[model samples]
Target: MTFKAAKEFNTPVGNYCYYHISRETYPIGITQIKEGNSVYIMATPEKALCDLIANQPGINLRYKKEALEFLEENLRFDMDKFCQFNPEIFLAYAKNGKKSTSILTILKLLQHE
Candidate 1:
């Protein structure tokens, strides 16, 4: 899934897919992964978590406890790896969204732990 500046058309199918279009730099969070002859650029776990929360429309993360619960239970993120996550790309993606604060809050919590 390549990042495009403009939104593209996708036919409805049983499988769900998302294409993030932005005027800013693309793949704000990504790493290259190779499997056999194929090479793919995909979001790191940190970016994936950020995108998931950011893309949601009206999720509430105002409370630290609730936010932590969501991350641990709903998202099932590995807290251990979170300490190694880089926020640069997630920040870029979250810059325009209301969820940026929540993302930062989570990151801050993870870092302090």
Candidate 2:
């Protein structure tokens, strides 16, 4: 499932989008973040990383260093919180080599970098 912002709505926060796999429908690694009086159900760092790779099939994270740079610089992921996640669940969603390899590569980089 894919959720995109409607053009009819305008906000200073820009557009928000999300993609989810149908089989993995259960809401896992999701948390609530409040801003002022509004609360939002957002995915955890782990879930967000998996979703990023899954949604973008053409992503180029060829090497460990590349993955590190992408996650640290391009994405700015929270490493401490990310490492706390269960690696097994992340691997379960990475069906093919594309997302799987990328996730694995990032995990490896997390160890040394």
**Local distance difference test scores for all models:** 0.67, 0.63
**Candidate number with greatest TM-score:** 1
Candidate 1's C-alpha runs over 4 A off are 1-14, 96-98
Worst 10 residues of 2 by lDDT: 1-10
lDDT of 2: 0.63
> Total clashing residue pairs per candidate?
0, 0
How well does candidate 1 score on lDDT at residue 81?
Answer: 73
For model 1, residues 1-113, the per-residue Cα lDDT tens digits are 33444244555655545556454535567789999999988877776777677667776676678777897898786777766777666567667544777887776666663
Q: Flag clash pairs in model 1.
A: none
lDDT of 2 by residue, 53-111 (tens): 75685776659878867877888877676567666556555543236677776666655
